[model samples]
Target: MSLRTQLTEILPPLLPSNPSEAIKGTELIRLARLQLNGAYSDASLRYHFSIMSCDPASPIAKVEKGQGYYRRSAPVPALTGAQELLSLSQGRLDDLSSDHEAVDSALERLRKFRAVVTRYYEVNGRFPYVFRQAFAQGASLGNLWKFPEVVLVDWETGDAPDEVFALDPTMLSLKQRLGLPPFRLHAARLRIHPSLASFREDFFQALSASMWAQGGELIYAAPVEDEALADGLRRLNAIFGVGVISFGLTAQALDDLPRAANILNAHPRETEALMDRLQINRIAAPHTRQHIDWQSLDGLRRESEEVQHLIGWLNDCVGKGRAEAFRDEA
Candidate 1:
C-alpha cells in the first residue's frame, strides 16, 4: 500500500494524508504530525520499524510525502532489528516508509518542514514531543528526571515515598522532540506517583498565561500548592464521574484552557506529588537558595519542550480524559 494510504489506515482516522497541504506548510503542526506517529511508538513495539536503534548516528525514519515528492531519492529500505524498529510501529507503516538512506535525513526533514504551522493554545505551555519509543526506560521517568527540589529529601527527615507510574515512552519522546514553552504546576502537594511531576508542567503552563495576562493574586479557590489543593481538585473529579483520575489525568487534550484550573483542582493526586517535589528535607542539599541548581536554568531552557510535553500529558486527563495515546507506545 502507498505510504499515504498506510498513514491514513493506521492513524486515528483524523490525520491528513497530505499533512503539509492540509496544514499549509506550518512547522508547529509538523511537530504534531511527528508526535502522532510517536503516539504509536511504544516499548511494546508491534513491529521491527518501531525501534529507535536503527539510526546509529541519529534517529530518522521514512516520512512519506505526496507522490513524486522525492525528486531523485527512493523510499527508505525495510529495516530489521533496530532499523526496522526505527522505521515504523506497524507492518503496513514499515512497508510504506522511505527506501532511501541519508546521513542527515532526519535533520534535513526538520529543515524542509519548517513551514509547518503550530498550535497557539498552550497545551500546558510545554512542548509536545517528550514521549517516544524508548523514553520510559531511558533516564527521566518519575523521580529520575525530577526538578532539583524534588530529589532533595531529608535523610534526617526520613526518605519520601518512592513513586512509580507508567507512561508511553514514544509519546514522551514526542514531547522532547518538539520543545514548547515552559509551564508550571500549581497544586496542593506531592507524592510518589509520577502524575504530580507531570502536574507541575501543565498547571504552570495554564497559569503562566492567565497570571501573566490577568495579573493575579492567584485563586486559592484552586490548589496552587499541595496542602491546600483538595478543595480545588474535586471539581474535575466529579466531571465525568468515572475512572481513576490518578491513573492519568483529570485534564483532557482538547480540554478548554479555562477549565484546566478547575480540573487540576479536582485531581489532587498530581498536585500532592508537586508538593512532594517542593518539600525541604534535612538532606545536606537543603532547600536553601545555596543548594538550588540555578545553573540548570540554561539546561531547562533547552528542555522546556520536555517540560511542555509533560504538562500536555498531565492535562489530558480531564479535557481529553487521558494522555495522548501513550500507553500503547510506552
Candidate 2:
C-alpha cells in the first residue's frame, strides 16, 4: 500500500479536518521522505509545511505554538492551545482511551489544585508551605536571624488559622495530644525584614512580575476590613498598576483564633479578666476543653492525600501510555 493511503486511513480519526494544513502537509513530507529513501532535506520539509505556521486550526500547530507559550511561562495561552489540540483529537493524542475515567478525574483534580493554589496565593500572598519550603531556606540569609515563619494550611484542608503560635519544632510529636492536625503544623519561613518597611514593596513587585509573565494577579490578604485600609490598598493598586484583592479571615480562622490565643496566653488571670471585660466566654481547662470538630480537619487531610495519589497516578499513566503508544506506532 502507498504511504499516503496508509496515512489516510490512520490520520482521519486523529486529524479529521486539518484546517491549519498541519496533518496534510506533514503527511506530504512523510511521503516525500519515504520516496527519497528517508533522506528528505530540512529545507524541503520546511517549504512543504511552512503554511501550517500561519494556520492555528491544526492540532500540530497548536501543540508547537503551545510549547513556545509554555517556555515563555505564558500558561493562559499555552493551556488554551493545548486544550484545543486535546479536544480536536478527543484526547487520543495523549494515548488516553475513550473510557479513561481516571484521566478525567485526574484532570479535574488538577483543576481543583490550581484553584486552591490561586485562592491560597490571593489570601496569603504566597504559595503553600509545600511549594515554598524547599526554597525558603535557600532564598534568605540564615546568618541574619531566623526568618518570620508563616503557617500555610492547604486550602482544601479547611480554613487557615487566624493566628500562628510559636512552637518548638522538636515538640511536633505532641500534635495529637494538642488536638492539632498534622498538616497544620507545617510552616514556611518568609523572607521579609522584621522592620516591615520594604517588605510590601518588594513582595508586590515580585508578585506583579510573576503574574504578568505567567497570567495571574497578585492578591493581598487583609487581616481585617476597614474603610481606611481599603482606601490605602486602592491607592497602592493605582500606583502599582496591579489589582490587590483583599480577603478576610475565614470562619474557621475566627473560631480558631480565640482558642489559639487562649492556649498561648501564659497569664491565665489576665486572660480571664480580659474575657470578662469583653463579655467573651472563657475556655475551660485543657482537659475539659470543648469538643472540637476533628472530622473537618481529617477530611482536609484525606483530600491532600488523595490529590497526591491522583497526581502520581496521572503522571505514571501519561508516561507509560505515551511510551507504549510510540513504540506500537514505530
Candidate 3:
C-alpha cells in the first residue's frame, strides 16, 4: 500500500502500552516518520531573508555600535508540526473503529490523575511530588493529558506486605535502567485508538518523551496540538469521585486544593498521618509510584462507569500481558 494509505490504516488505531510497546510499534514509527517527512521540512513560504547593508556609523552609530547586529533577525526555527501527526492518526483511527468507550475512559483517567496531583498540593502544602521533582528541573504536568498513575503510586504497593506482587519484571528492569519507578504512568498511560481492535506487542517498554517547566519546576510533557494547556491541570478538578481517600475533615477539604494544602502544610503531621486515616488502597501518592492496581480499580469504580473502566483495564492489561510474555521467555 502507499505510505499515505498505510498511514491512514495505522496511525489512529493506536493503543496505549508501556514505553516498550509505544517505542517498538513499527507502523506508528513509520507513520510518524512519514508525517514528519511530508509536512515538516521545506514547507514554509520562502521569506525575504537579507542582511541590511546600512551605514554602521550614521545616526545609529552616534548611539551604540553593537545595537545594529541584534536587529539582524532570522526566520523561526526549522518548523516542526504535530497537526499532521495527530490528524493522520485521528483519521486512520476513525476509519478503523466506532468505539467511544476508550476515549471516555482516557478522558476520565486524565481527570482523575489531575485531581490527585492537585490534591497532593492540598495535603502537603506543595505541588505533587512528581510535580515537585519536575520543578527541580523546571516543569509541571500537562493539563490536557495528565498521567495520574505516574504521580501517585511508587514502584510497588504491598497489598499483602511485599515479597509477591503484580508488575512486569521486564518493565521493572527497563525502568531501573531509565531511573524511573515502574509505576502507574508507565503501567496505565496509553496511545489509544478506541476503535483499534488489537494492540501492538511492544508499546510497554519505550516511548518518546518531552519535559516542560512551570512554577519553577520540571514535569513530563505529552505531545499534542494545544500548548496553552501547558499547566491546565485545573481541568482535573472537574472529574468526579477521584480523591475519595478517607481522611475525615481532610476528606471534607479533599475536594478543595487550597483547603487540603492548608491542612497538610499547617499540620505537616497530616502527611504522615494519612495512613492512619485511609485504607491501603486509598493511600495518597505524590510522586512517581508505579504500583496502583489500576486494572482492579475498575471494579471499585461505580457501576455506571464500570463498563468504560473495564475497557481501560483491558487496554492496560494488554501491556501487562505482553510484559509477562516477555518475562516468561526471559
Candidate 4:
C-alpha cells in the first residue's frame, strides 16, 4: 500500500481527538510503523505526515501552534459566508442527522452556555440581554449579521445584588452634556468551540454585529488551550478591537450543569459555586468607543423588536435614575 494510504488507515486509532493531547510527529511515526505495511524511512514518513495533515480529507491533522497531530472532528452545520452556526434553525437541524436526541443535546448545551454567560456577566456587574427571537427555530439566517446573541450593558454607576442600581444623576447629566454615552454597550457572540478553522468568522461576526454598539466580544464556552488558536484570536483582536474570552467550560462540563432556567435564576451562594467552576481567560480586551452609532442603532430598532425593547429599557432606566435588570414583558 502507498505510505499515505497506510498512514490514513493506521492513524485514526492512534491519534488523539483533543488538540491538547495531540501526539508529537516522532511519536506518531513510531506508532505508525507497527501497522505500516512497508519499511519506510523516518524522514519519508514525516514528509507524508506533513503533506497529508494539510488535506482536510486526510485522517491526520497537524496542530497549528505546536508539534503534534490530532483527529479533526466532523464539521457543524454553518453558513458558508461567516460560518455562523445554523444548528438552531429547523432546516439546518434536519441536515444534522436522523438522531433527534443528539440534536437536542447539542442545543441544550448551547442554551446552558448562554445562561452561564449571562449569569457570569450579571454577577460581574454587567447587565446582559439575550436576543432569543433572532436564533429561535425557523428564524432567518441573516439575523446573525443584524443581531448579537447577547448585548452587555455597562452602567456608569451600579452594583449587583441590588434589584435596581441607582445611577449617579450628576455624572449621567454631565456625560449627556459632553456628548458621551453615560453607559457602554457591547455586543457578544457566543460559541461552544474554539477552532483555528472557524475563529476568523467568529471574530468578524462579533465585529459586524457590534458595529452599532460601543464594543464587541466573542465568547467561547470551551477552554482555548491550543496556543495557535489563541494567538490567532489575539492578532484579530489587535486589528479589529473585538475582545475574545473563554469560560473554560468543556461540553461535558456544560452537560453537568443545571438547566438553563435554573442557571439563570441561581441564588447568591449557588451563583458563587458556579463562578468557582469557571477558569475564565480573557484572550483580548475590546476597544470601547465613546459614542454609539445612533443611525445604525436606529436601523436595528426598525428591524428588531428586541432592539426596540432594549432601547426602551435603557430609556426607562435613564428616566427613573435607576439601572435595573431587564424584565421581559413578552
Best by TM-score: 4
Put down candidate 4 lDDT per residue, 217-273, tens digits, no spaces: 999898876555677789999999999998989989999999999999999999999
- The TM-score obtained by model 3 is 0.19
* Reference-based lDDT, residue 270, model 1: 48
Q: Candidate 3: lDDT of 240?
A: 15
Candidate with better TM-score, 2 vs 4 = 4
Tell me which of candidates 2 and 3 scores higher on lDDT: 2
TM-score of candidate 4 on Cα atoms, chains taken together: 0.82
Q: Candidates' TM-scores? A: 0.16, 0.22, 0.19, 0.82
- What are the per-model numbers of colliding residue pairs? 93, 0, 37, 0
On lDDT, the leading prediction is 4
Off-target runs (Cα >4 Å) in candidate 1 are 1-76, 81-101, 107-129, 133-330
Q: lDDT scores for all predictions?
A: 0.25, 0.30, 0.27, 0.81
lDDT of 4: 0.81
Give stretches of model 4 more than 4 Å off. Answer: 1-10, 24-26, 32-69, 77-97, 158-164
lDDT of 2 by residue, 79-121 (tens): 2212322221112233444536644543443232223333333
